[model samples]
Target: MITHPKPQELTEAVARWIEEIRPSLDPRNAFLARVAANALAAVTRELTMGEQAQAAAVERLEALLGHGGTYAALNWELCEELRAGQMDTATPGLLMALRANVLDQLAIDQPTYRHEAS
Candidate 1:
Protein backbone atom coordinates (compact mmCIF):
# COMPACT_ATOMS: atom_id res chain seq x y z
CA MET A 1 0.00 0.00 0.00
CA ILE A 2 1.10 3.51 -0.78
CA THR A 3 0.68 6.41 1.57
CA HIS A 4 0.02 9.99 0.53
CA PRO A 5 1.22 13.16 2.16
CA LYS A 6 -1.28 14.59 4.58
CA PRO A 7 -2.85 17.96 3.82
CA GLN A 8 -0.86 19.62 6.57
CA GLU A 9 2.34 18.13 5.24
CA LEU A 10 1.59 19.38 1.75
CA THR A 11 0.91 22.87 3.02
CA GLU A 12 4.05 22.87 5.10
CA ALA A 13 6.13 21.69 2.13
CA VAL A 14 4.75 24.39 -0.11
CA ALA A 15 5.32 27.01 2.52
CA ARG A 16 8.90 25.85 2.91
CA TRP A 17 9.42 25.99 -0.83
CA ILE A 18 8.07 29.53 -0.90
CA GLU A 19 10.48 30.58 1.83
CA GLU A 20 13.39 28.91 0.04
CA ILE A 21 12.66 30.83 -3.13
CA ARG A 22 11.76 34.13 -1.51
CA PRO A 23 15.30 35.45 -1.15
CA SER A 24 15.87 35.08 -4.89
CA LEU A 25 12.68 36.90 -5.83
CA ASP A 26 12.33 40.57 -6.72
CA PRO A 27 11.04 42.71 -3.87
CA ARG A 28 7.42 42.62 -5.02
CA ASN A 29 7.52 38.91 -5.71
CA ALA A 30 9.31 38.30 -2.45
CA PHE A 31 6.54 40.10 -0.61
CA LEU A 32 3.97 38.05 -2.47
CA ALA A 33 5.86 34.86 -1.70
CA ARG A 34 5.92 35.82 1.96
CA VAL A 35 2.17 36.31 1.91
CA ALA A 36 1.69 32.95 0.21
CA ALA A 37 3.94 31.24 2.72
CA ASN A 38 2.06 32.84 5.60
CA ALA A 39 -1.22 31.70 4.11
CA LEU A 40 0.06 28.16 3.70
CA ALA A 41 1.29 28.15 7.27
CA ALA A 42 -2.16 29.20 8.43
CA VAL A 43 -3.68 26.43 6.31
CA THR A 44 -1.31 23.88 7.85
CA ARG A 45 -2.19 25.06 11.31
CA GLU A 46 -5.89 24.85 10.51
CA LEU A 47 -5.57 21.36 9.07
CA THR A 48 -3.71 20.20 12.17
CA MET A 49 -5.67 22.08 14.84
CA GLY A 50 -9.05 22.98 13.42
CA GLU A 51 -10.97 19.89 14.55
CA GLN A 52 -9.83 20.09 18.15
CA ALA A 53 -10.41 23.83 18.28
CA GLN A 54 -13.85 23.45 16.78
CA ALA A 55 -14.79 20.68 19.17
CA ALA A 56 -13.67 22.75 22.11
CA ALA A 57 -15.60 25.73 20.84
CA VAL A 58 -18.71 23.61 20.48
CA GLU A 59 -18.31 22.27 23.98
CA ARG A 60 -17.86 25.74 25.40
CA LEU A 61 -20.82 27.04 23.46
CA GLU A 62 -22.98 24.15 24.60
CA ALA A 63 -22.13 24.73 28.23
CA LEU A 64 -22.63 28.47 27.97
CA LEU A 65 -25.92 28.20 26.09
CA GLY A 66 -27.10 25.20 28.07
CA HIS A 67 -27.82 23.21 24.91
CA GLY A 68 -26.10 21.03 22.34
CA GLY A 69 -25.64 21.98 18.71
CA THR A 70 -23.43 21.92 15.67
CA TYR A 71 -20.79 24.64 15.81
CA ALA A 72 -22.33 26.72 13.06
CA ALA A 73 -25.78 26.54 14.59
CA LEU A 74 -24.50 27.34 18.01
CA ASN A 75 -22.31 30.13 16.76
CA TRP A 76 -25.18 31.69 14.87
CA GLU A 77 -27.42 31.36 17.86
CA LEU A 78 -24.82 33.00 20.01
CA CYS A 79 -24.53 35.89 17.61
CA GLU A 80 -28.27 36.27 17.45
CA GLU A 81 -28.56 36.24 21.19
CA LEU A 82 -25.86 38.85 21.53
CA ARG A 83 -27.46 41.04 18.88
CA ALA A 84 -30.79 40.75 20.60
CA GLY A 85 -29.20 41.55 23.97
CA GLN A 86 -30.04 38.12 25.34
CA MET A 87 -26.38 37.57 26.16
CA ASP A 88 -23.53 39.88 26.92
CA THR A 89 -20.44 40.35 29.02
CA ALA A 90 -22.81 40.07 31.98
CA THR A 91 -23.93 36.62 30.94
CA PRO A 92 -22.29 33.88 32.97
CA GLY A 93 -19.48 32.12 31.13
CA LEU A 94 -19.97 34.28 28.01
CA LEU A 95 -16.76 36.28 28.20
CA MET A 96 -14.66 33.29 29.11
CA ALA A 97 -16.08 31.19 26.30
CA LEU A 98 -15.58 33.99 23.78
CA ARG A 99 -12.05 34.58 24.96
CA ALA A 100 -11.21 30.90 24.69
CA ASN A 101 -12.72 30.60 21.22
CA VAL A 102 -10.80 33.66 20.01
CA LEU A 103 -7.57 32.35 21.46
CA ASP A 104 -8.04 28.97 19.82
CA GLN A 105 -8.65 30.61 16.46
CA LEU A 106 -5.60 32.83 16.92
CA ALA A 107 -3.52 29.73 17.54
CA ILE A 108 -4.38 28.62 14.03
CA ASP A 109 -4.51 31.99 12.29
CA GLN A 110 -1.68 33.88 13.96
CA PRO A 111 0.29 31.84 16.42
CA THR A 112 3.00 34.47 16.73
CA TYR A 113 0.64 37.30 17.48
CA ARG A 114 0.92 38.71 21.01
CA HIS A 115 -2.20 40.03 22.65
CA GLU A 116 -2.50 42.01 25.88
CA ALA A 117 -3.71 38.97 27.75
CA SER A 118 -0.75 36.99 26.55
Candidate 2:
Protein backbone atom coordinates (compact mmCIF):
# COMPACT_ATOMS: atom_id res chain seq x y z
CA MET A 1 0.00 0.00 0.00
CA ILE A 2 1.09 3.53 -0.64
CA THR A 3 0.52 6.56 1.55
CA HIS A 4 0.39 10.21 0.68
CA PRO A 5 0.56 13.39 2.68
CA LYS A 6 -2.75 14.74 3.87
CA PRO A 7 -3.76 18.25 2.83
CA GLN A 8 -2.99 19.61 6.28
CA GLU A 9 0.41 17.96 6.19
CA LEU A 10 1.20 19.39 2.78
CA THR A 11 0.16 22.85 3.90
CA GLU A 12 2.25 22.59 7.04
CA ALA A 13 5.26 21.51 5.04
CA VAL A 14 4.91 24.36 2.62
CA ALA A 15 4.43 26.86 5.42
CA ARG A 16 7.56 25.59 7.10
CA TRP A 17 9.51 25.84 3.88
CA ILE A 18 8.33 29.41 3.42
CA GLU A 19 9.46 30.31 6.91
CA GLU A 20 12.86 28.68 6.38
CA ILE A 21 13.44 30.72 3.24
CA ARG A 22 11.83 33.89 4.48
CA PRO A 23 14.94 35.18 6.20
CA SER A 24 16.90 35.11 2.91
CA LEU A 25 14.33 37.14 0.98
CA ASP A 26 14.45 40.94 0.67
CA PRO A 27 12.45 42.90 3.23
CA ARG A 28 9.32 43.19 1.08
CA ASN A 29 9.51 39.59 -0.13
CA ALA A 30 10.18 38.39 3.40
CA PHE A 31 7.03 40.13 4.57
CA LEU A 32 5.09 38.54 1.75
CA ALA A 33 6.56 35.18 2.57
CA ARG A 34 5.43 35.59 6.17
CA VAL A 35 1.95 36.44 4.98
CA ALA A 36 1.94 33.39 2.75
CA ALA A 37 3.05 31.21 5.62
CA ASN A 38 0.33 32.65 7.82
CA ALA A 39 -2.25 31.91 5.16
CA LEU A 40 -1.04 28.35 4.86
CA ALA A 41 -1.27 28.00 8.63
CA ALA A 42 -4.89 29.09 8.45
CA VAL A 43 -5.52 26.57 5.67
CA THR A 44 -3.94 23.83 7.75
CA ARG A 45 -6.15 24.71 10.70
CA GLU A 46 -9.21 24.78 8.46
CA LEU A 47 -8.33 21.41 6.99
CA THR A 48 -7.96 20.00 10.49
CA MET A 49 -10.84 21.75 12.24
CA GLY A 50 -13.28 23.10 9.68
CA GLU A 51 -15.53 20.03 9.45
CA GLN A 52 -16.10 19.79 13.18
CA ALA A 53 -16.63 23.51 13.47
CA GLN A 54 -19.15 23.54 10.64
CA ALA A 55 -21.03 20.56 12.06
CA ALA A 56 -21.20 22.21 15.44
CA ALA A 57 -22.43 25.43 13.88
CA VAL A 58 -25.09 23.51 12.00
CA GLU A 59 -26.23 21.76 15.15
CA ARG A 60 -26.39 25.06 17.02
CA LEU A 61 -28.38 26.66 14.21
CA GLU A 62 -30.81 23.75 14.02
CA ALA A 63 -31.41 23.79 17.73
CA LEU A 64 -31.77 27.55 17.87
CA LEU A 65 -34.03 27.79 14.82
CA GLY A 66 -36.04 24.76 15.87
CA HIS A 67 -35.45 23.08 12.50
CA GLY A 68 -32.88 21.23 10.44
CA GLY A 69 -31.20 22.25 7.20
CA THR A 70 -27.88 22.59 5.47
CA TYR A 71 -25.36 24.97 7.08
CA ALA A 72 -25.79 27.66 4.42
CA ALA A 73 -29.57 27.46 4.52
CA LEU A 74 -29.71 27.47 8.27
CA ASN A 75 -27.28 30.38 8.41
CA TRP A 76 -29.37 32.34 5.96
CA GLU A 77 -32.54 31.57 7.87
CA LEU A 78 -30.93 32.75 11.06
CA CYS A 79 -29.98 36.00 9.41
CA GLU A 80 -33.51 36.44 8.09
CA GLU A 81 -34.93 35.80 11.51
CA LEU A 82 -32.67 38.39 13.03
CA ARG A 83 -33.55 40.89 10.34
CA ALA A 84 -37.23 40.18 10.81
CA GLY A 85 -36.96 40.63 14.58
CA GLN A 86 -37.84 37.01 15.18
CA MET A 87 -34.62 36.44 17.04
CA ASP A 88 -32.53 38.77 19.15
CA THR A 89 -30.05 38.96 21.97
CA ALA A 90 -32.79 37.81 24.35
CA THR A 91 -33.39 34.65 22.36
CA PRO A 92 -32.45 31.81 24.68
CA GLY A 93 -29.25 30.61 22.99
CA LEU A 94 -28.67 33.11 20.22
CA LEU A 95 -25.67 34.95 21.60
CA MET A 96 -24.00 31.82 22.91
CA ALA A 97 -24.35 29.98 19.64
CA LEU A 98 -23.11 32.92 17.62
CA ARG A 99 -20.20 33.42 19.94
CA ALA A 100 -19.22 29.79 19.71
CA ASN A 101 -19.40 29.89 15.94
CA VAL A 102 -17.27 33.03 15.76
CA LEU A 103 -14.72 31.62 18.14
CA ASP A 104 -14.37 28.47 16.11
CA GLN A 105 -13.81 30.47 12.94
CA LEU A 106 -11.29 32.69 14.70
CA ALA A 107 -9.42 29.62 15.83
CA ILE A 108 -8.94 28.63 12.21
CA ASP A 109 -8.41 32.14 10.84
CA GLN A 110 -6.37 33.83 13.59
CA PRO A 111 -5.50 31.56 16.42
CA THR A 112 -3.43 34.33 18.00
CA TYR A 113 -6.25 36.82 18.14
CA ARG A 114 -7.10 38.12 21.58
CA HIS A 115 -10.47 39.53 22.53
CA GLU A 116 -12.39 40.38 25.67
CA ALA A 117 -14.00 36.97 25.64
CA SER A 118 -10.65 35.26 25.25
TM-score on alpha carbons, each prediction: 0.96, 0.94
lDDT score of residue 13 within candidate 1: 92
In model 1, what is the error at residue 13, expressed in angstroms? 0.9
TM for candidate 1 is 0.96
**Where's the lowest-lDDT run of ten residues in candidate 2?**
1-10
Once superposed on the true structure, which residue ranges of model 2 sit more than 4 Å away at CA?
A: 1-3
lDDT value for candidate 1?
0.94
Candidate 1 lDDT over 1-118, as tens digits, reads 2238887888899999999989999999999999999999999999889999999999999998899999999999999999999988899889999999999999999999997989
How would you encode candidate 2's per-residue C-alpha lDDT over 16-115 as one tens digit per residue?
9999999999999999999999999999999989999999999999999899999999999999999999989999989999999999999999999999
Kindly report which residue pairs in candidate 1 clash with one another. none
All candidates' lDDT scores?
A: 0.94, 0.95
